[model samples]
Target: MATLRIGIIMHGVTGRMGMNQHLIRSIVEIRKQGGVTLANGDRLLPDPILVGRNAERIAALARQYGIERWSVDLDKALANPDDTVFFDAATTQARPALLKRAVQAGKHIYCEKPVATNLAEALDLYRAARAAGVKHGVVQDKLWLPGLRKLQLLNDAGFFGQVLSVRGEFGYWVFEGDLQPTQRPSWNYRSEDGGGIILDMLCHWRYVLDNVFGKVRSVSCLGATHIPQRWDEQGKPYRATADDAAYATFELENGVIVQLNSSWCVRVRRDDLVTFQVDGTHGSAVAGLTDCWTQSRVNTPKPVWNPDVRQTHDFFDDWVKVPDTTVYDNAFKVQWELFLRHVAGEGEFRWNLLEGAKGVQLVELGLQSWKERRWLDVPELTGREGA
Candidate 1:
């Protein structure tokens, strides 16, 4: 079989999401699987060059993953003619400028979400990529999640007939680094470094709601910095200026109401770290990251609430687990494969930079809602074709 080698410059891959999800789990896994086969009998092989600030770290990553190329100089990597694709999973503050440079070099761009810290910058990146006439995409990996995919399947089968509302609970307590080390990077709790739960997670919820349920029409949000002090990577204490938690409500254009609670301070007591409960007229399904439990209207149990007596009913027993019908790959890897195929002119990719901008817009509105203490209307982002 003929092999078409596609060169990719992976930047900021030394970071947590970048290293684990994009590089090791996705690209390395694809390489291990003998590359992606196309319909025309040609296989697409990825030749990724790890790019980062630290030479030693990048070299170690390359050696660990069997990657042939590693570079500390991003400009030199971008200047190479063979590297047609540029992927970034860097901090939100550095994204716009990095993407701009990539688009100028005429490279196809794919990146982690919250494409920019603000809607204006996010829109600028989309416009630039469009003007450069390059293929572009952003990570909305939740759309490919198994549980959410099951929800989509159920929705398609009319299991959730006339959906009325959606409730999403996402978050887990992160150590404050005093007694135990912090699980997340300290920059995540600093506003100067583009850290905040609203900016970080609202982007995710926006796409999940828009694609899975309906387009978000408006939003009302309240934010809090639950842990005011946390230790950094160097074991130094720092004041947390960014919000660690957010309670947000969204109104969908299709009349479905959505509520999401995202935090790094709250403990997880649900089926998974994240769960979405979709309530409909005929049935209801509660989906975690990897599992879904559904309860049909017929299976719904009726009970009267009485504070005086001890409750005997087991509420969890009423729902039936959704069976796994097919093998599922890593969500990030699935999106990466589709992006590679799209870059190769195989099919359409709807989640472009414009969609990324929409996510940022939601983040902006959510913050505005928090500040104003009222609901904010989410206006449509116009001027881009197929936006």
Candidate 2:
């Protein structure tokens, strides 16, 4: 069998999402499974070099994952001709400069969402990558999620005839790090450090809305910093200047209305940490991170409002659980395999740098909407591949 070893520079992987999702669950898992197979009987094997600020921590991570390479010098890694692909999962604020350098070095680029703090930088990065003629991509892992996959299947099957509206509820109570240790990093709460719920989650929402439902036309958003004070990793008190919660509404090109509520200040009472409910003319479905439940028009139950008495009906019993007909792999891993194939010229990759810029545009517009207290039109980004 023909084996193609592809060198990849993995940067900012010391962070939680970078370490767990990109490295361990995706890349390492691919290695464990003998790499991605091609149709022409060749296998594309990834050779990843971990790049981070802390040598000791990165070295430990590399050793733990059975990786042979680890480096703290990004310039050294970029100088190597063998490492053709540069993957960044670094802080959002640092992404633009890192990507610019990688693109200048003529390396294929892949990275996490919110490509930049604003739309201009994001578009600039995209343009630079396009000018360099390097393969580029952004992470839209939610589309590969099992629950969302099921929703896609249902849409494909025409289960939701003339899909009407979508409601997304995401996030949960993140401890203030005063008494209980915070689950998320301290940087996520600092605006100067590129921290905020809108910047972080809106990117995910934009992709999900565009790919699954329809292209977003306009947006209305309201943001809040519910918990003003919190403790950092060092157990010291700090003012949380960044917004922790967002209530947003989107109007799609297809006339579908979408309302999304994202917050870290609220407690979870839903089926999962994040849940989406879609209602159509013929049916409705609720999807969590890994599960989906559907209720058809025929199965819809009629209920009478009685505010004076306790309701006896179990409202949750009407929807039927969607079954998993096929085994699902890790969402990030699935995307990674696709990217590998795309790089090898075996598949098409639509989620490119321009798509990432669209996500950044949504975040920028959302922030503008919040500030102006009015609906903002999501203008189409110019200078894309087709445009």
Candidate 3:
């Protein structure tokens, strides 16, 4: 079997998403599994060079993971022909510039979501990548989640005869970093860092909608800063400049409606940090980060309309648990394998940069809708030209 020693120039490997999702879960796990086997019985191994501005952090990560290569210089790393891929999980503001540089260096591109903070920048990045004729992708990991996969299966099987609506509850209370340090970065609450709930989760929601319910045609949103301030990692006070919560309603091309509530300040009382409930004419299903269950109308007995009588039957007891037919890995790891396969030309990669641009468009429209307090129409992604 042939071995593909793929050199990966991974930027922002020190950050939360970079470390946990890209480095540890995806790359390291793949290495531990004796590399990914190609369809033709070949094997592909990732030779990652960790790139970052911080020397100490880079060295620490390299030692921690037994990674041989580490570099503080991105430009020098990009010049290496061995590094055929450029992966970024940098701050939203840094993504466009880094990706542009990667394209000019003739590297395949992969990056974290909200590809850019705005629609124009996102579109330009897509356009640039298209012109470069490079294989590019944005991490759309939620689609590969086990619970969501079950939902997709049910949807595909037509269990939901006519889709009616989708309701999503996403979030958990992040620490204020005052007495205790926050779980997320302080920049997430700062606008200057390209941090906002709408910009972040709307990207996930866009793909979830397109893949499961239908294509989103328009949206109306209300964004808010529920918490006015937070403390930084150094225990310094910082003013919250970004919206922490976003309430958005989407109208799909198929006429199905979706309501999503995303927030960082909200308290969690559900099964997981993220939960999606989908209701249709024939059945209803609710999926969380770890579990998915469905209720069919056949099991739901008809009830008489009575104002004086007490309800007898238990509605919640009727839901059946979705069977786990296949072994599922962590969300990011699943996507990593898929991307690796696609890059090797074993299969087609559908989640390209244009789909990422559409996500940015949804967030842009969301912000506009919030500002004007009106519904906004989302434009179609009719290839590179329309985007």
Candidate 4:
């Protein structure tokens, strides 16, 4: 059997997302499953070189993963003939240059979103990859989320007729690390680190809206930095310059409205870290990452406000929980398998750099809306002409 050995330059593999999601959950899990079996009876296995600046961390991760190849120098890895793909999970500020170099090096590209901190850099990355004739993709993990899939199915089945609006509530209190250590890195609270709820989450919202609701036409956003100060890993105090919370309203092309509230300083008492309640003329549905509850107008009872008498209605009981029929793995892993299939010429990769650019575009308009204190129009990306 001929081996289709694919080498990946995995930058920022030491970080949380890199360590947990990319390395442990996706790639390691894939390998443990005996790799992806092709229809031709061939197997596709990734030979990823863990790349980072810290030697001790790299060594520790290498030992943890049982992988031999590791590198501190990115240039050397990028120059390697064996490395066919460059995967970036680095900070947003570092992604543009890294992606440009990778494209110029003639490697396939896959990275976490928003691709870049701004639209121009994100657009440039797409154009460069296109010009270099290399396959490019971005992580749109939410599209593959299990609970959301059921919501999509319900929408497709017309369980929610003439969709009216969507409300997304996502957040959990991030410890200041003064008394309790923060779960996320301190960089996530600094603007210089490309850390803001609006930039980070609106990218996800764009894909969700495009995939589930409708194409977003305009947005009005309000951003806030509720947690003004925080402590780093070492107990050093730093001001939280980036926004920890964002309240945004988007108007879709289909005239359906979306109200999203994202926060890192709020308490979580909901079903999941993220909950989306989508309402239509006929019914409503609420979905988290793993569970979905829905109710149609047929099952909904009409009610009127009465101050004289006690109301008799079982609102929460009216909604029915949607059973999970399809098995689900990690959201990003599902996308990864699809991307691998796409790269192998077995299927199409719809979530390309252009789709990533749309995400960047939405974030840009959202920032604009926040700054200008007015609704802003979202312009189409260069590659979204026919889309």
Candidate 5:
């Protein structure tokens, strides 16, 4: 079997997500599985060079993964013609410039989402990638998630007949770094560092809503900085300027209403860290990160409301668990495989940079909706809106 070697320059992967998801789980696992098989029966293998500003951290990450190449010089790495793909998981503000440079070097582009901190910058990256005439993609990994995939399958099979609405609950209480060490990075709670749940998570919800249910038509959002103070990496306390929580309502073009509550401050009493409950006339399904439970019209339990009396029904027991029918891989890894195949001239990749820009556009509207306390519309983008 002939294998096509594809060189990739992976930047900022020394960080948490870049290390765990993209590098270790995705690329490393891809190597172990003998690369992604193309439609024409050829296998595509990634030879990635880890790049970052911190020499020690980057080198250690590379060594831990048994990767040979590691570099602190991004420019030098980008200039290498052998490395045809450029992937970045860097800071939001630093992403546009880095992507612009890489595309100019004639490399195919792939990176983590939010693409930029704003819509204009996000559009600019799309424009640059298009102008460079190289293939481009973004990390919309949630689209391939096992739970979401199961939901998609149900949707495809018309299980949720006449879909009505959706509810998404996502978050967990993050320790304020004093009583217990914070699980999230300190920068996550700082607005100055390109942080905030709205900016970070609205991007995720945008894609998930648009792809799974329907295109988001508009948004109404309320944001809050629940805990005003949090300790940083060095155990130093600082005022948190960014929002930790957001209660958002979305209207889909298809008339499906969606309510999503995202917060780092709230405790998770739900099924998973993130769960989507899709309700329909004929049936309803609640999907977590891995498993999905469904209550069909035939099996759904009816309840009576009486405030004075104790509840008689067990709501949790009403739904039937959807059995796993297929083996599921890491979501990020799945997206990476599709991107690799797309680069190898296999098929069309719908999750392009422009799709990523749409995610940023939603963030802008969501933040504006919060500030104004009113619903704001999401306009369709064609990547030619005078960026």
Candidate 6:
């Protein structure tokens, strides 16, 4: 009967991902749709105040998005009693302190992945939010991806009997800013600036593995800075102190082995920039960002691997495409609506700060496994003693 307006403080949305995905695609689209419809037939509208260190950039973004509220001072923004939610998509090193400040300000928290640089900090952030008695969530956008959703459906339907392993190839060449401008921020290749493929992507693998297929039990990873020299945004040359490539092997609890290669130096040769091939006893499927192809045991083609003779196998023809029977929305926007509903007492939100901390734990173990040159077991995480 009445509109439920939720005030949200949106910080660090002046950057690429913050500006594109979170601001324009998710929040703006939500506002365009006239807000999220609640279970009781009421709509929950988000009133966002954009905040950033760059006043000019922030103001430009606000005006472009038709948002009236904008601020450069985070403290002043947090002081607004009307705003109950704080969302951050900023640099990894700055996320903890910002989220902590928001928690202290009695604002609910939602943030991007790798919650902190390390496991302890991530857990502490979760603890701070818990102590403040504020609702919290993390961005686990891949769960709703259309291709992965199809994989989930097939897995749920027992389409792949006795799953064996998953192999993921994710990457495309990012320019070094010499001849071609770099697509990623220069900070992404600097370790001191919270840069590295392992730190950046392992958290994603942690959740995707646990939620989609099975819980990861152990990890073996090797990191490399394939491109040592890179140019920054200003075209200044600098030594890349971070690993641009990560070769990780994860053993899931169900005995499924997952090998994922994440790199910024490799060329794209697959169906998509990122693809996951799931092989099982009865069937197999390969999924990209938007499409998934499956090949049943009955339909699989027989190929002879003979170096002596050139055989025309037509290797890619055996698999059939998966249809989208259900309509899908933007992954980030879908999660946003779910979190907003959870904050408004719709239901339990499972992907909280604690879940996010688990991702950080995986990152820690992944780096340790690489450093020690051995597989490290992932110990089960629990809440702080006696809560």
TM-score of each: 0.98, 0.98, 0.96, 0.96, 0.98, 0.98
Error of 2 at 364 (Å): 0.7
**Model 3 per-residue lDDT tens digits across residues 1-387:** 888888889999899999998999999999888778998898889889999999999999999998999999999999999889999998999899999999999999999998998888888898888898989999999988988999999999999889999999999999898868899998999999888888999999999999878999999999999999899988999999999999999999999989999999889998689999999999999999778999898866676789888888776678899989999898998777777887788787888898998899899899999999999998787556535
Candidate 2 residue spans exceeding 4 A from truth: 384-387
Candidate 5 Cα outliers beyond 4 Å, as residue runs: none
Q: Higher-lDDT candidate among 2 and 4?
A: 2
RMSD of each: 1.5, 1.4, 1.8, 2.2, 1.0, 1.2
Compose the digit string of candidate 5's lDDT tens values, residues 248-345. Answer: 99999999999999999988888999999999999999999999999999998767778999887789999998998999989999999999999999
Which wins on TM-score, candidate 4 or candidate 5? Answer: 5
User: Candidate 1 residues 341-385, lDDT tens each?
Assistant: 999999999999889988889899989989999999998887363
Clashing pairs in 2: none
Number of backbone-clashing residue pairs for each candidate, in the order shown: 0, 0, 0, 0, 0, 0
> What is the lDDT ranking, best to worst?
2, 1, 6, 5, 3, 4
> Model 4, residue 226: what's the lDDT?
89
Better of 3 and 4 by lDDT: 3
Predicted structure 1, TM vs. truth? 0.98
C-alpha local distance difference test of each model? 0.94, 0.94, 0.90, 0.89, 0.93, 0.93
What is the Cα-based lDDT of residue 276 in candidate 2?
A: 94
Predicted candidate 2 versus true structure: per-residue lDDT over 213-250, tens digit per residue? 99999999999999999999999999898999999999
